[model samples]
Structures are given as structure tokens and as C-alpha cells.
Target chain A: MDRQAILVELKKVLAPYIKNKELLDGITENTNLITDLKINSANLVDIVIDAEAQYNIEIDADSAENMVTIQNCIDVIEEKLSSANS
Target chain B: MHSAGNDVVAFRLTDPERSAQPRFYNQILSPSEIALFHSGALPSLSFHIFLWLCWSIKESAYKFRKRYHPDLVFSPTAIPVTEIRATAQQITHEGPQNASTDPQITGTDHQITHPVLQITGTDHQITHPVLLITNAAHQITHPVHVITGRTEDLFFRSELFPEGIHTVVYRHPDFKSVRSGYAFLQQALGSNHPQTNGATEPTPETQSAAVRELVLLDLRKRDPNGAWSFGKHKEGYPLLYRNGVLQPVPLSLAHHDQLLGFSYLLPVS
Candidate 1:
């Protein structure tokens, strides 16, 4: 899947966890999960798990740690999806 | 508790804004932890506590590791929580006749009873991943033994404020450990130092300094000869010592809204 397509699914996974709805609406590839959406550090796990189930991909420890931004999430999902397809 | 090689963490659970964010978990937890959350094995409240529990364990483990490897950097994913068992604290409330019993009470003038959280747990087997620092690296897959202790409570004067979770981890299971010195930030800053700007809502750094001082002051009473100097060791872990001698006694520090605390193992004689 492409970045835009992955972002759509990402938004769905993030909606419930984001405290700032305005930030969520304006979220882009550059948006940071902690600074922009003000997501609590604890809920980040839920997003990772949800993203895996939503996109049907697994995120490793290193990738999970680097998944601080929306773009990072998209990159990991895309990579995982492609690798699985290959 | 005996303090030889133990540490504790006190975190504020009052911030609804932070608690709502989903990205926060990524910064602190490992992959297996996320799976545990998905497993739905623990209750909602227990799960929430479990999150903090994991955080405390990592934090405590970091403190423990810092003593041996000062350059060790803390990455929650790098440290895995192996086992945890719920433990109970037997608290006996013996105080003044009416309300004002606990001296650590803040935010209100009226006397109130402090509710000690029932469910607290301890974990002994927490593993630290191989670390690679600036020009210095160490790899150890061996799981380090750490004893973790936790407490959760919601302090209130009128309205119920957010719950605070306090946790301690000891390098040696037999070592005694404790976390104390709860103070209001506003009151502590004003009385401790006669500075001009007594900002009610100080930054996290400011709050941490004030709280660290209060905790250190309380710690000093136990060992009058032990002059604790603060500095960063190998991987920027905070170091403390009594007198001029370098002490291996592990110490952990934390500060959050309206609270700051320290946990350490008392040096074994």
C-alpha cells in the first residue's frame, strides 16, 4: 500500500488516542505523535498494536521506538506490507 | 526498607491529556509489553497501573544498571519486564485524633485520610539489552535481578486530584529501600530558597530540582557524614555519593505535577 492509503488507516487507529482533535484533523506526515497530538506515552503501545492488527503487519522493537511520528508509522507499515507481499 | 541497591519512581497519573495520547507508549515499552496489553489479561485499572508498573521497573532497572555501568543509556524497549507478582503493603494509620495525620498531605488545609493503594507488585527478573553509547558500547543479554515495589494513591483536599504511582527497584532483593519526602512545589521552592520568582506552575526541570533538594535533604538526615554530590556518570545517569567516596548505592529520582521523590537502597554496613 502507498503512504496516503496507510495514513488513512493510521488516522483511524490514532483517533481514539489523540487528546487534541484539532491537531488530529490537521495531522500530516510531519506531525509528531507526542508533541502534536499530545498522545500519552502509555497509549503508544495501543497504537502500535492497533496499527499491526489494522495493517496486518508486525513492528519490531527498533521500529516501534522510532515510530514517533506519523511518517515513521507509514514507513514501517509500508515496508512490512511490501516485505510480506514479496 | 534497607537501602543498599534499590531505586523507586513516582509518577503522576493526573494528566488526562497525557493519558489520552497513543504515541506515549511507543517511547517506553517493548514489543512483548504491547502484546500483553492486547492480551486483555489484566483489568482496565490494573492495566493502567501495569503500564506505570512497566515504566517503574525500567526506571528502577536503569538506576540499578547505572551503578555498574554508568554509561548505560535508558531505553524502555531495551529492558524487558520478565515477571511481576502483586504484593500488599500493610499500612497502619496512626496519627492525630481527627483529620490531620499524614504530614505529607498537600493542596488543602483540612485534615484528610490518605488512601494507600491495595494492588502493588514486585518483579525480580528484568533484562537489559546490549547498549551502544558514544564511542563506548556494552552487550549483556543476561537478565539482571531487580526487586520492584509500587504504591498508587489519589491525594485530595477538596476535589480528587490525579493518582500518583510510586515504585522502587532494588538490585539486591534483601536490601531495604524507601521513597519519601512529599512536598508541595510552591511551598518547597519559596521556603528552601529566598528567591524572587515563586512561580506556582514551574517547568518540569524546576520542579525536579526543588523536589531533588527536598529528597536529598531528607536523605541527608539518615547519613549526616555522607555528603551527596550530584553529577552525570558514563551514560548521563545521575550519581550520588556520601562524603568524597564514590558510592555504589543505587538511587533513582522523579518529578511530576505537584510531586517529586527519590528511591535508593541504604548502604549495607
Candidate 2:
């Protein structure tokens, strides 16, 4: 439910595909998904798949376009979380 | 007349040495948004399943790259390629007669077929994780170079990979390419140039919990009907012959969970 917790969980699922050694070591929140973490759009779909499976929420195709960076990915999750809670 | 008919039937049954029918499957994944995967900064984020495939290919390349220096590729099918260490080609095959030259290999002519991953199943997996950058031959050929990279810089830099690709460029061999290329993507938000590379290999620091298999082949000379099959290697690599010399070609790694396809064929004696 918490944004940070959700982000952490999402990162865990997405981590396997990413080469962490290329990123700044010790990843934490505020890591730029695009620049710092280097998450691409194609694989982002897989992240979306993993997140939906984890939290059980469906992310629409249009909304996914905005989820670019780590922050964007987190922002989208927060939006989905808030909407689902309401 | 009856005896002749029986002899033909017997010959068919006795030829146990015949090769199995080659397997081929259609691409199961989509062709949409493939450029997006290629444009990313680090391919690791999007090409999750493919990362493992590429790493395995790179490892296999190391075994033969130094010793054999393989030049031609005969992948019955080609898909988006990510892992290559150092070699000449990225060529895929159409068949025995139609070995179309890779455009990258045509002009320069300095090519080694770096890690050719031949299999019957890429058609099903292409669109699952990302869009493959097969050489333009996908339209006309059996094997394709779904995607390719040359120098280290093009892979890691942002400028090199535009649009859907910049953010993933952190792992690209160059950081400046990212800074320079993104100058416009962030500012004008208009125009995107796709920086492509030639040979790419996964470094030790980058690979993850990927699963792959190693297989061996024995290429004893002068036997056209002579085929070698061993039960030990779960993943099978095809052996190639060009100009009367033999070359070893690797198939993709065997998955652990996969039930052996031809388990019953092993000789009891």
C-alpha cells in the first residue's frame, strides 16, 4: 500500500532483467529509472506485467506510455494504488 | 513384384540413421514497439528473457571465437540479437543453397559469425520481452539479425539509442554518446536517431541468474552419412561444413524444466 514498499517490490521483480552492475550501486528510491537505473520501455512492459501480477491491478496501454523512468514507474504505481484504494 | 515391394519397405524401416525432421516455428511475439527496446540505454531492463539467451551465446562464442574464428552463420531463423563478444558476422541462413550475406558483413568484409544461435523456436519468443532487430533480411530470409551492435560506445550511450532506447543506455559502452544524443530528445523532444552496433558481448559483471547449456560435437572427416549424436549434451549445437572443413554451430541453451524431446531414442545396448 505504501508507495516506497510497492516500489521496492516492483524493483525486485524487475531486477532480474536489469544489469545492476551498470547502475550506481546500492539502488534506493529517487533513482532515475531512465538515466540512473536505465530501464527501457520494452522491458518496462514486463515490469508492468510483474507489477500487475504482484499487486493485482491492470495497467492500461495508454497509461503505460507515461511510465518511463524509475520515478515515472513509481508515480504510475502510486496512482494505481491510490485509485484502487478509493 | 511382391518381393520388390517388401524390400523397399524394409529399406525404409532399416534406415535408422536418417536425420530427424528439422523443426521450425512461427514468431510467437509481436513486431510492435521493437524499436523501443533497441533504443533503451541498457538492454537489460526490457530484454529479460533475451539477456539470458544472449549471454549464453556470448559464452559459446568464447569457446570457438578464439580457436575456430567462425565466419558464416546458418541460423534457420534469426531474431533480435543482444549478446556478441567479437566476431565478423551475425549472418543467419535461409537454407543450404541461399546463404545471403549480412549487410553489415557485405561491405566491410571483416566478419566472424559471432555466436550464431540456431533453433526452431525463436518465432514464438520474439515479441514476448522485446522486438528483435533482425537484419533487414527478416522480410525475405529464414534467418534474421533482429538487432545488432558494433563498438562498446553505441551500446551504453544515450545519444546512440534514441526515443524508446535512451534510458536503457547506461550499460552501453559509452556515456558521452548518451549525453550528446539526448541533448535534443530532452530539449526539443523532436527527432531520434537509432545508433546501431556490430558485435556485442556480455561482460562478467552484467549476467544474472540466466540458465544455459553447453554441448559438444565430434567432427570426424569424410562421412556424409556420418552423423554424431550424444546423449550427454541436452542442448544440441549443429556442426557445419564449408569448403570441405567442419565448423561447430551452437543451438540455444537447453532449459532445465523442459522434458527431453527425444528421450526414448537412447540405445539400450
Q: Write the per-residue lDDT of candidate 1 for residues B1-269, one digit (tens) a residue.
A: 22211222223332334433455565566567767666754322344445665665565555555555544444666776543432222333432112122224211122323432233222211111100010111111213432222221111011011234434444333222333334445445654443314433445456658766765666565657667777656543466766766776555565545544455544545
Candidate 2 lDDT, A1-86, residue by residue in tens: 77768767876766755655545355666665534564432244455666767877766644554565566667788888788888
Writing each residue's lDDT as its tens digit, candidate 2 over B27-97 gives 11223223433565333342432233232222222222212223323121232233322112233432111
Docking class of 1: incorrect
DockQ for all models = 0.10, 0.02
> lDDT for every model?
0.50, 0.29
True contacts kept of each: 0.09, 0.00
Question: Candidate 2 versus the native: TM-score?
Answer: 0.31
Give the range where candidate 2 chain A is weakest over 10 consecutive residues by summed lDDT: A34-43
Per-residue error (Å), model 1, residue B43: 5.9
**Which model scores highest in DockQ?**
1
Model 2 Cα shift for residue B178 (angstroms) = 21
